[model samples]
Structure formats: C-alpha cells, structure tokens
Target: MSNVYIDQFPAEAKVIRAAFYSSFLALALGGVFGIIQTLHRTDFLRFMDSVDYYTVLTAHGVFLVISFTIFFLVGIFTWAVTTSLDRGLEDIRFTWGWYSLMAIGITMTGVAILAGFTDAIDMSASVLFTFYAPLQAHPLFYLGLVLFVVGTWVAGVDWFRSWWAWKAENPDERIPLPTFMVLTTMLMWYIATLGVAAAILLFLLPWSLGLIETVNPLLTRTLFWFFGHPVVYFWLMPAYMMWYVMLPKFSGGKLFSDPLARVVFVLFLILSVPTGIHHQYLDPGIAEGFKFIAMTNTMFLLLPSLLTAFTVVASMEHGARQRGGEGYFGWLKALPWRDPVFTGMALAGLMFAAAGFSGMINAGMNINYLVHNTFWVVGHFHLTVGTAVALTFMAVTYWFLPQVTGKALWSRSVALGQVVVWFVGMTFMSNAMHRAGLLGVPRRTAEPQYEGFEFQAAVGSIGELDAQIALGGVLLTISLGMFFANVVGTALNGRSDDLPANEYAGALSGPDDAPLVLDNLKLWTAIAVVLVIFAYTFPLLSIIDRGGLFGPEVIPFPLTVESATTLGFALETAASTSFESAGEIATSALTAVMR
Candidate 1:
C-alpha cells in the first residue's frame, strides 16, 4: 500500500537536515559563550575582561540569535511550504546561492568578532546585538550583517517563488496550514529586516568609517529597534507556528480554530513591527508622545499573543479530552506523556507563554523604568526567547529526527532528562536575574560590583541562584550530548527501509477535506511596511534638527554617573529648557550627547 522508500526520503528533508546541522553548530558555539558569560557574571570566571566579554557576547548574538535561528527557520519554512503544496523544493538555482551567502557571511562575521576587529566601532563595552547607535561595531561587522540578512532575504524569495509556482500548477487548491503560517512569518521577517538593513548600511557603517563625525545615534537606535523588536517575533513565529499547527494534532485533536490562527498571524504583521519605539522609552531623542503611541500599540500586541496562548491551551485541552481526560487538571496528565513530541511542545508552550506574559510588563512605558537595562530585562527575555523558543526548536528536532534519518531515538529517557534540566535551569537563572535587578544589579557587564548597603545580603542570595543554574546546565549538557548521539546513531545504524513513512503530524482535516491555498502575504507585507513607516516617521524626523532634537553632539564618548542623570533632564529640554539654565546644563548636555 505504501511505496515511499527510506533512500527516497524527500529532498526537502535533506535540505532541512543540512540546515539543522548548520543551526546546531551555531547554537553549540553560542551556547558555549552563553555559559562563559554566565560564569563571568557570577564571578565564577573572572579572568575574562571587557574585551573578551564583548567578543563572546558578539559571537553569541550573531551566531546564536542571528545565524542559527534565521537559518533554521529558513529550512523549516521551505520544508513546510513545499510539503504543504505537495511539491519538492523549487527555485533550486537560487537555493545554493542563498545558502552560500549565508554561510560565508556568518563565518566572516564570527571571524571578525573573534579577531577583535569590532573594536574599530568604539566597542568600548557595547555588547548590544543589533548594536544600536550610540554604540558601534566595525564596518566589516555591519557588512557581514548585511550579507547575512541578504542571504535570508534570498531564502524568502525562493519560498514564495516555489509556492507561487505550486499554486499556478494547481489553481483551485487551498494551501496547507503549516505552509501558510510559514509564508506569514517569512513576510514578517522580510519587512522587519529592512529597518536594521537601512540602519546598518546607511548609518552605522558610515559612522564607523568616519564618514560622519556624528550620524545621529538616536536615528540609528530608532531604526535598529524597528528591526530588532520584530526580529524577536520572527524567531518566535516558527515556534508559534508549530505550537498552533502541530501541537494540537500531536495531542490527538482537531485544531479548534484554524482560521483564527491565520488571523493572529495577520495581526502580528500589523502590530509587532511598528512598536519598536517602546524600547526607546528612556532615551531622550524620541518624544514622549511618540513613545506613548508605541507603548499603546505594544499593549494592543498582547491581544494577538494572548489569543495564541488561548488557542494552544484549548487545542491541548481537546487532546486531553480525546484521551479520556475529564477534569480541568486531569487533562494535564491525560496528555501523551511518553510521546516526547507532544509532551515537549505542550510544556514548552506553556512555560514560554508564561514568560511572554512577563514580557508585556517589560514592553510597557512607565513599568520599563523599573527594569530598564537591568537583570530583570535579561531574565524576562531568557524566559521567553531562550527558554520558550529554544525549547520549541528542540522539541521539533526530537519529533522529526527519526523521520528524517529513518532511525529510532537512541535514548528517550535521556532526551526527557535534557528538557527537564533546561527548563529547571532557566527558571532558576531567570528568577535570580529578576531578584538581582531588584537589588540594583546592572546587566551587560563582566562583573557587577556593589558597595556596602545590603550588598552582602544580595550576593549571598545570588550564590544559590548561580548554583542552580550550573547544576541545571550540567544536566542539560548531558541531555544535549544524548540528543547528538541519538541523531547521529539513528542516521548511521537505523536506516530502516521497511519502516512506514512518518506522516507529518498537524491540524489537517480528514482524507475528505480540501487543502488550503498558499495565500500571498502581499497584503500583510504591505500593511507591515506601512505600519513600520508610520512608526518610524516621527522618531526619524527628530533627527532633522540633529542638535535641537538630540542636543549638540558632544563626546569623548562614554558618560559618567553624574553626567548620566544630567543628560536625562537635557533630553527633556526640547519640551522645557529650564534644565539648560540649571548651570549644570553642560554636564547634562554632555551625558545626553554621549549616551
């Protein structure tokens, strides 16, 4: 009855495998640096200074955040889109071009960072990824970034081209759910990357090269955030896609509202990209009114995110009920616990969405001041991005690996242990970070030093948190080691040619249902473009009167503690110049200019 063969596994699977290999390599590199940074933060490792810290940070950011996530998404997007259309990878000519460019760009950027070439752009201590203006990286770093982004863009085009050709071939059919979501996310990433691309190519690169003594750091930061904020959504989109499209089916239920999931994707295209200005709330260059609008829009974004949470929960509930789960809490146990795929996704979704709830607070205007640039912010992101998103990726890999390689998992027990370790470790790590921030511990440093007041009390608490993180990491590392072994082992030893073709689990109707049309993201893309333009207009316009908007550019570069406070008032000078006559105006202006 079935004719598909192991050796005849879909070509898309091969491409995905290659992509996973690349992404896993990057993750490994980044994770190593992440561990080093964590150790350095807790004073477990003190030999690394600022330069070393930044180098590790940059590598982690570029490789892990940029290269690994984007590349993995590209492969997954392509696979989902092609499979849904009942086709293999199309636009084959450009696929290699895209991969080559991305591979080269990632390697070059990593080399530049490790070579200390990033020092060219006032690397002093700026470890911010997306390197918002007011901080800079070398022109090579920016170019590398541009090249990498272009590579991803090329991948997007390939996806659309293939999907479009598929539609033309079969004009009457609807696209598959998984593929539709992939296109939606691709459209979002394409629109979002433009802002950062512009900032890097138009501003940061030139400024780093001395093309302009002052390139208006405010404008640069504004543009970078325009890209930066949405990119987070981009990383999460695939995870979200899997959560909505696959998780329910894995739990053994119909997707409650398939159409609603699409609508939520559409909403993200409208809302997420335009709210970047909220990140600039504390900065003076952006107006309070503009920031307020951004903040309000950010609040609106919670609607779609919450909608997603509800959808996932309801779907899981259906699965639980299907399995004879009755009570509210009983469904939790009724879930397919031994099925690593279902359980992993459900738990990861619940945990990450919990983290996302906290993110709403971080995105708010006034509340941001309480955690701005602090470990609380750090903790919040790790919960969402690191814990939530990363776990989903892991879930996917585990779910699909056997299918891809025609092998059974080498050690299910070990894989389960790994997920538990990662989750427990992250909770401890993030909670400690939140408490540390409340105790006034700053983030993005090699060492956080403190003076007399309750510092010892604070330090004592951190030791327990740090120990938890270390133990968790050890467990996670063991799990990860098992995963690598399982995958490689299955690939080589368990190519069971007689095994059944593993059907991709998802929220599809029964054999009688019509397939979905691969909808064009053109409207969504256009709406996103318009929203981004509107969002950035006021922020960018402020740069027109550079001196007036951001205050006169004064810099020997970094600011002192006293100047930092003065600069705060100076940024508000445009609305009220009373601070200019405070006799402390120069110091304030200097801080404002330097920051």
Candidate 2:
C-alpha cells in the first residue's frame, strides 16, 4: 500500500485539498487581473477603461497576496503539524470550521472589490491592497478581512492545540522542527496583527461605516505598516519552512543543522514585527529617529535571511556530495534538476538573494528616498513574494497534489517548463520595472507617460521598457496556463499506488544536539512582545499626540470626478487664505517688535 498522506490521514487530506483548490481559484482570479493591469499599463492592450485599473489592481493584490498565499500556507502548516506529529487533528470539525470561515470571508471581500466594476451593486472597494486611509472601501471589505484574519487566528489556535497535546504525551522530547517553526511564526503573526486589527476594528471599519467622521491618515498608515512589514515574513515563513525541511530531502540529503533552523525561526519571530516602520521612512508625522530605529531593525532582519541562505545551501551541498558529486561547483550537477520541486525552490532562493540586495536599499532610509513609492519597490517585491513564495508553492504543488489526491502528476515536463517560464517572465518584467523606477517613473498609475513630459531612460527608450513589460506579462500568462493544465490534468487522472511516502528531511545536527533553551517558546514569545512594545509604543503615542485620535477636519476622499474637482478648488482656496493670514501675522509681529 502507498504511504501517502491521504492513506495516513484521509480526513485531514480532504481539508487540505479543499484549501489548495481555494488557493488555486484565488490564484486564477489574481492572475487574470494581473495580466489585465500589466497589458493595460504597458499600452499593449486597452480593453478596459483606465479608470478601472485600480479595481483590477485591488483584486490582483488581495486575491493573490491575502487570499491565495494565506489559504495555501494554512494548508501547508496543517500538513506540517499533522505529518510531523504523526497524529490527526484533535477536532476535524474545528479544522473545517476555520477553513469555511476563511472561504466565506474572502468571498465577501472579493465581491466588494469586484463590485467596483459595476454600478449595479452600489458597492465598490477600489482601495488598493494597502487600503490606506482616505481611500475608503465598503464596510463589507473591512468586515470580510476581519473574519479572514480571525479565521487565521483560529487556525493558529488549532496548531497550538496539537502541539500542547503532543507535548503532554512526549513531555521530555523537544518540539519537532516543523511544529516549532509553525508555532514561532504564529506567535509573530499574533503580535504583528494587533496593529492591523486595531487599525481596522477601531478606526478604518468604523470610519468606512460612517461611525466616525474622520481618521488620522498618518496614524492609520502607521498601523498598517506595523502589520504590513511583518506580513511579508508571514508569507515568507512557509516558504522558508519548505526550504529548510523539504528541499534537502528533494536534493537527496538530510538537513545540515536543525539547531540553526530553529535559531533562524526564533530570530524571525523576535525581529519581524518591530521593523515595519521602515516602510514609512518618507511619511511625515513620524520622527526621523523612529525611522532610523526601524531601519536598524530591518537591517537586523537580514541576519535571519542570511542564516537561512547559509543553512539551506549547506544542506543542498551535503545532499549533492552524498550523491557522489565531487568538487565545489561541480556538485551542482548532481542535484535533481528534472524535479520541478527542487529546481523551483532552488531558483526561488537564488532570486531571493537578489531581493535581499534590493531590500537593503529599501531598508536604508537615505537610499530608500530614491525608490520609495516607485516601480523599483514593485520590482523588488515581485522577486520576493511573487517568485520566492509563489514559485515555491507552485513547484511544491507538483509533489503535494499527488500526495493529497492519490493521483500521479500529469506531466513533469510541463511542470518543469512552467517554473522556468515564470522565472524568465519575471526577469523581463522586474528588470524593466527597476530600470523605469530609476528614471523617476511612478507606480500605481494607469498611465506613466504624459503628453508633454517624457521619462529619459539612460540606455534605452521608454517604449522599449514598455515592450519588455508587455512581453513579460504575456509570458507569465502562458506560464500560469501551463500550471493550471497540470493541475487539471492531475485531478482527472486515476489513483496511483506508487506515490512517495509523506516525509521531510532528517537533520545531520538533530534537535537533540541543540540547547534546550532553543525550544523555550515562552521565553522567545516574551522577548518578541517586548521588542514590539519598544518599537511601537512611543511612535504610536507620538502620532496620536500630533494628529489627534480623529485628526484635523479633513474631508473624505472624493470618488466622483466632479467631487474631485470641487475638492481641488476648495483646497487651493484654503491654501491661499492660510498663506495670506500667515503673512499678516508676520507683519503684525514685526511692527510690534520694532515699536
């Protein structure tokens, strides 16, 4: 009999399959919107009105980053907990409950965003992914996000429940590496989410529903970044878990060091939440000192990533050597290049190294000014979450789908081609984006070119960059199609009894080799909470003190063209009056002083 996951835990497998399907659905929706925006922005295709671009952008962002990635990782985490512990969920019903909550929540949020395309629904949420203040969305959007996050919170509880139960039975044993990873990540998430939860529940949600007259935009932004920056790691930790636990096995070697992996996760848990202020380096209201502190925290974050790089690469090398590969660089040939899982993850890691370099530039407050809110930032993230996280998930899906479904993969060749094509497409797209950003091109706009103004490229014409972006978009669309083809084909295939057993790599330096303190979850969580408090308490107080809890008498954003025009005129008039009053005051002060 095959020792696949389905055979071992049929009920849990079903839930995982459901989660994967949901993730794929979101990926499809997001991919469609992704191509639409890419083609429209590059002027290669203009089927939709430019006004609809923000709607498309919002959908693409929410569906992929919020829905797709989270849904998929939840499944992965559940699997990690179950497979590593050799136990089924304590309550299968509870598992289904959380998944259902997530599904319903995202569906509601998705509907609100899609409603932007039509006046028929009398609802719209064109607020992009950041959902920054003044760009208000419907209450349903906020409510739905609440439920989704809450569902994740419940999911975290489920993992903890499993760990606690396992600990009871194996009291003296160290926490399993995968479980340890999931727990640490969840702790970080819990801390990080407090910001967004406060932002939405206390401010954004009520404001959107007309319960509040106004909000401090800077305050809301600060709250968002507190959640925003760490959320990057939330998306990334699962990918890291896969890299640390699964990649070595696929490379034909055991993990190089379990202790190092635990330390990396611990570092991430402690450091991830406090560094979000770096995203707001250019924003007013926050002091430069706080921004500098955020920058310092962000730089410290690089240590965990570097450790990950060293440990994962070392594991891969050990695997290669075990396969009789000799010499330093020559051992690379011994890797299982034919396996989409290994190649995809390896390439993702390589791309992440590039992301790290660009990320440093972003973390540096001075250098960041050049690219803040520019296309370069967009390019940098595409390499990080776009490739590193997305590619790793897709590649691993080849292995995971069969395990869950009891079916053989339809075409390994197509799967391999999909990963390669995605890498190439992103290279073309991200490179052009970075180049354009360097030339002062702005992001989040449907039209980058103006009638009288032209962006002068150092080496190439703007037209060339547009072409590259369009080409990349087309190639990416093709890659997505290939990926879906494999998925559908596998779902249609008959059950196979020859599937590989469900397992992760063993460590050369096992958990026992590590100090007991490494597994002290309470100690690490305490430290993480302390760091977050230190990083955010003063900054939050300063923002509220300067900008009030409700802020100045600021008008809500204008949605209609007429309203926008009126607001513009009003702002211009107000500015003129203020300047005149300031001049009179100065004149009066000078006369009094002279007398």
Candidate 3:
C-alpha cells in the first residue's frame, strides 16, 4: 500500500476531515444559491422577489468567494503543512481553535445575510461582498469577517511554526516545496488582510455601529479594493499550487521548473496589491494619472500568469511524454482522462486560460469603458475564481479525500461525470452571458427589466440566451449534487484500498537550482509592503484632501433596499450632518490637518 495520510498520522487525518466537511458544506450551499441567482439574473426563473435578489446575490458571493474558497485553502494548507513537513501540527487542539474561529465567523456572517430575508430582524448584511459605502451592512458582518481573517492569520502562524520547528532538526535541508508554497501564499495573505482589517475596524465596522456616522466613500472604497485585488490572487494561489505541484503527478510527469515556480510567486507578492486601483477606473474620485499608473501595474501583473501558463503546460507535456506519448500536440491524448482528479484540474486550467484574456480586457483602460458593470464582467470572473478556483477545489477533493480517509473513491465514473457536467454547464452559461453582455444587458439585477428597448443579439435572441443560462445552471446544480454524493459515500467507506503515495512530482530543475533570494520571504514581504504604500499613498491622500476625515459629510443609503437614484451620497457638506455644523466641522478639520 502506498503511504496514506490516515495510515501515517491518524490524528492529523481528523483535522483534514473536518476541514473537508467545512469545505463541502460551503460548496453545497454556494452551489444552490449560485444556480438560483443565475436563473434569477437571466429572468427564466423568478421565485426570489426583486427586493430579496440582492440578499441572495450576497449569499452567492460570500458563501462561494469567501467561505467556500477560504475553507478549502486552509484545509489544503493544513494537509500541505503536515504532509510536507513530515511532522504533525504543533498541537491538534490549537489547529481546531483556528478552525472553530473561522467556522463561527462564517456562521455569524451567514446569519447576517440570511437574516435579510425577513423584516422581523432589523439586522441585514445585504451590502454584498464589496460592502462599498455609503451603502453599509450590519456590524456583525464586519465583525464576522474580522474573526475570519484573524483566524486565517493565526493558521498561517501555525504553519510557519510547524516549519520553524522542522527546520531546526533538519537544518541542512531546504524547505520542502509544499511548505514553501504554503508559507509564501500565507505571507501574501497576511499582507492582503491588513487592507481589509483596516477598512473594517477603522471605518466600515465603526460606521455600521453608529460609532462614526460618516466615512469618505472613496477612501473606504480604495481600502476595500486594496484588499480586493490581492484576495483574487489569494483565491487563485491554491489552485496554482495544485497546478504546479499536483497536476504534473496527475499527468504521470514531474514538475518542469521549480525555480521558475518560486519566481512566479515572488512576482505575485510584489505586484498584486499595487494594481487594485485598476478596479476603480470608472469611479470619479480617483485621478486619471493614478488610474494610469494602476493600469500599467495591472498590465505587468499579467506576465506572471502568462509565465505560469507556459510552465504548467510544459510540465503536463513532460508528463504526457513520460506516459509514452509522442507528437507536438498529440501528446495531450496521453493525459489521464480516466481519473476525475486529472480531468477536472485540466479542464479548470483550460477555462482559466480564457478567463485570463477577458481579465486583460477588464484591466485595459479603454476597453473597460465599453463593458464595465455588464454581464461580461460577471462572465469573465465566473470563468476564473468561479470556475477555475472552484472547479479545481472540487476536482482535487476526489484525490485528497481518499488519501486522508484511506479509501478508494466511491465511484470513479460519478466523479468523472461530475466534472464534465460542470465544464459543459459553465461553457453554455458563460458564453451566453458574454454574448448578452456585448448587447448591453446590465449585470446584478433581479428582473433585468427590458421592455423599453429590445436587445438584439448578434447571434441569438434574449430568450435563447436566457434559456441557455438556465439550462446550464440546472446542469451545474446537478453536478454539485453528484459531487456531494461521491464525497458522502467515500467518507462512509467500510474498506480501504492500496493507493500511491500522497506526493507531488519533483521539478526537472529542483530547488537547488533556484537562487537563494527566493527563500528570503521577509525581504520579499517588506518589498511588497513598500510597493503597497507607494501605490496607495497618493490616491488616498488625494481623496482625503478632497474629503476630510469622517468625510465631507454624507448620508448612508442601503443600496439593496433603495432605488438607483439613492446610491449617491445625496447632500453636499453645506447640508450634511457631522459632529457639529457642517461649515464648522469642515473648516476646523481642514485647519487642524494643515496646521
């Protein structure tokens, strides 16, 4: 029998099991809301009232993007830390502490969102994941996220502590590849969390509590995006880790270049935070020059992803060749399609490649003007974090579960069918959404009201597109059910099976070939912080200059409950409320700051 996680360390297996359970629970809930929201968006299905649509959309975004994605990352990182270090956690009790904190945090936030369904509870957090003010959520939502983020930070420290202890004994050896990946990704996350934390504690949470009634809309928004953009990479990094480390094994090949892998991660740390301003290109408060700088940085950020595409493909090719395949592109046929783990990950990568092109357009200063806030943007991300990160997680679960549980998959065919259905569903849905977007169909609405003017599609009618999206959504939901059945059956398995070692492929050019500087995570982290400061300082100062602290006065409006006209902060400082009379407050603050 190949060495399994269960056979080697049974106690640790329980931790991984809890993590998986947490993950799939989120996947199940997220999958349900996702399909409902999709159907509602296309207008083919309309059970959710127009008023409640934003609530469901909030659930879809938070459950999938925040809860589902992060739970899986922590689980995968746990497995990575334990398996790579070849040592158990510092204490399983400590491990569960962070897990419980995260679970509690998610529940608190989830309650706030679900509470929005009824007026009986005045508490509601329908302010979607962005939480852009002068639209605010309940204080519980911010507190929940704080608990969640802090939990992750502690989890990182746990992993780092594990490595530090291991290194002391194995002083001569380099950090294991998995451990290295975990550490760097967590480091990036630690940096990323600072943005959101400050946004919450200093501003959003306080404002929601009525502790501070007003906040600079642009300042809070800038801070949110500061964390916002890097969190995308945070979501993608685990999938990328699987691609770099696990996909090659799935293909029966080894990693192509370990050194290049280090370089890719280092690039992400330095570039991800600085480029967040690109998300605000359409916003009014930020200057054109700052936007231009962000655009340039955003463009440079693509280079790492492009390099990743090249390296991942090369590694898969090497695996194909090792399996006795020959040909320029024909070697693709040699890949392990029979294994759901291999097929799901491969298809996820294919979708990500397309998502990448769309992202570049979104990053473009000029092109973004044509398609901002349309279903095209929705379609673009569904292919990325939605399909790419999410699909990869579902796929890896097939392989990782058995390793942790010491059992064979319940049914390989079911797992295979699950991934295929997901890819087919996303393809139909994403394509139609993209097409409709080009026809000027706006995104994120319940009814998508369109009686004023008929949207003429170049290739198909609106009815046809809606039908495709609805059909695709149904298929996707079925795929999620199939995934659940497979997981449940495997978890209840009565017998164990012999399996290959739970190990990733090594690189052709190993860590020995990589420069020593790549190991200096501290140096990289410091540089990353400096880059963030340099990029954000100017735009933030400009916003502050325009609006005083607590902002040049404004009123809060609930975006989900109010009409479109209500989105803006209605009154200028002259009519605005503050700690004192508006003029007194503005003049005093300006004088205090300048002095």
Instruction: Provide the overall lDDT of each model, using Cα atoms, as 2-decimal numbers.
Output: 0.71, 0.93, 0.87
Q: Residue 35 of candidate 1: its Cα lDDT?
A: 79
The lDDT of model 3 is 0.87
Give the lDDT ranking, best first: 2, 3, 1
Pairs of residues clashing in candidate 1: 174-515, 174-516, 174-517, 175-516, 175-517
Measured on C-alpha atoms, candidate 2 has an lDDT of 0.93
Instruction: Show the lowest summed lDDT stretch of 10 residues, model 1.
Output: 509-518
Best by TM-score: 2
- Tens digits of per-residue lDDT, candidate 2, 412-436, equal 9999999999999999998898888
Residue 280 local lDDT, model 1: 80
Q: Report the alpha-carbon TM-score of model 2 versus the true structure.
A: 0.96
TM-scores, all candidates, are: 0.87, 0.96, 0.93
Candidate numbers sorted by TM-score from highest down: 2, 3, 1
lDDT of 1 by residue, 405-522 (tens): 6566666776676676677777667777776776667777766765554433434676676665556555555556665665666567655555445445455333224323214467
What C-alpha RMSD separates each model from the true structure? 5.9, 2.6, 6.3
Runs in model 1 with CA error above 4 Å? Answer: 1-9, 117-127, 453-460, 469-479, 498-502, 505-520, 547-595
Clashes, model 2: 0
Error of 3 at 295 (Å): 1.4
Clashing pairs in 3: none
